[model samples]
Target: MPSAIRFSGVSRHYGNVKAVDGVDMDIAEGEFFAMLGPSGSGKTTSLRLIAGFEQPTAGDIHIFGHVAQGLPPYKRNVNTVFQDYALFPHLNVRDNVAYGLMVAGQAKAERYRSAERALDMVALGGYGDRKPSALSGGQRQRVALARALVNEPKALLLDEPLGALDLKLREQMQEELKSLQRSLGITFIFVTHDQGEALSMADRVAVFNEGRIVQTGTPEDIYYRPEVPFVADFVGSSNVLPPEIMRDIRGVDAYGALRPEAVRRCDAGHDAWVRNVSFLGASTRVSMQVHGVAMTMLLPRGAEIPAVGSTIQVCWQQDDLHVMSR
Candidate 1:
């Protein structure tokens, strides 16, 4: 498949600061791809580069086989949805959604019709008359989506679009956003620090760190087979076992990643001293010291919870232990 967006040796530097440094990526057409990382990791900068909001210091950016670098945002066939929604309080939802078309010299009748169709796509069909202040946060977010979709861009660039919503609302929107992307069959480039949001909504993910992509793969590949320690620790809180621990367990002088949930309670295994037990709704997180190394295990619901300060035997399947390459 052709690429919706491509970056070749892309770098955006500010004096000594390299916000995006020598990054190469190919985002496929009609794919839902996520750039996942913490703040200042260059994920947001990458999105901006794609949207033409920021220019690359040295490299090429191609959007649908056309050179996108140095082009204005309006010239790129892409739309951006920001976290703050950026709605106009004075205008009604219909007018707000049609603002882009209005600016493009579209007539009132045509722009309003396009805006209404976009609003319907976001399930806000009847909210055309509502003002920005009259709607809730989620509704405003949908309005933002409608506004972005009004132009029917080839790709959608989202910069933490669900960041402002509450947990429940965010979860609800995740599903809706994924569904909408599939239905629209357009490239959706989502930038977020939330691992859950990326893993749940994106078809593929690029894990970023220190202005570079550490790993890029499907969610399962990133979670189960992290190539480096940073990815293992950041993506799902996996246990980054030291080389000594791996030597003791696998007779290999290398670091390994073990999922907390992969630690099983066996009658005969390594005895672990429980240090803390945290009840987290569906599961209990137990912090333990194993062979002098502090580790954690997540006990599933309905399982017997061990009291803190107690000792228990824990074991893991060999397959569950992923030996890191670096």
Candidate 2:
């Protein structure tokens, strides 16, 4: 498949500060891609650069084989959904959704028809006449989404689109957004700092840090086989074991990474004292200390919860060990 978005040595700067520094990446057409990182990590800057909201200080950006350097956001074959929703308070849901079409001078009747369909796509049917303030946070978010999708852009750039909603609503919208993306089959370049959102929704994810992409891979790959220490620590709450401890476990002198799921209770293995057990609804998080090294484990619900200060044998398979630095 051809590239939907491509960046070649792209850099954006303000004075001496580099927001996006020499980043190169490609998002295949119809792929659901995510840019993930902490605050000031440059993921949002990269998204804005793609949307033509921010120009590159150096290098070039391409959208569907066309150079996107000088094109205005309207000229590009994409639309953006910001964290704030950016919906017009004065307009009803219908007009807010049709705003883009109206700007393009689309026929009023036709735009309204498309707006209704778009609203229905976001499960907001019959919500046409409601004012922005009348809707809940989730509903207003759908309105913002409907507005963006109504334009039928080739790709969608989302900058923390789910940031404003409560947890349950955010998760619901995540699934909805994923389903919508699959149905539309358009490239979705989503920017988010949430690991669960990125892992659960994206076909592939690019990990950003300090204005650079440290690693890019499928969700499983990013989670199970992080190549860098930052990625291992950031994507999920991983235990980065010291080289000596890793060598003792794996017979190799290298930094080791293990997910919470990797460490498990066993009948025969190294002994550790359970420090704390946190009940997290569907799972129990176990914090233990082994040979003076603190480690965390995630056990599924219904498992016997070890009491605090109790000693237990824990073991992990060789396959679960990921050597991050050698």
Q: Name the runs in model 2 displaced over 4 angstroms.
A: 301-304, 310-312
TM-score to native of every candidate shown: 0.96, 0.92
Candidate 1 lDDT over residue span 1-326, tens digit each? 99889989999999999999999999999999999999999999999999898999999999999998879998988999987888998999999999999999999999999999999888999899989999999999999999998898999999999999999999999999999998899999999999999999999999999999999999999999998989999997898899988898899988899999999799999999999999999999999999888889999999999988999999999999999988
Evaluate all candidate structures by whole-model CA lDDT and list the values in order. 0.93, 0.92
Candidate 2's TM-score reads 0.92
The runs of at least 3 residues in candidate 1 whose Cα sits more than 4 Å from the true structure, single-residue gaps closed, are none
Q: Among all windows of ten consecutive residues in candidate 2, which has the lowest summed lDDT?
A: 317-326
In terms of lDDT, the poorest run of 10 residues in model 1 is 68-77
Which candidate ranks first by lDDT, i.e. highest?
1
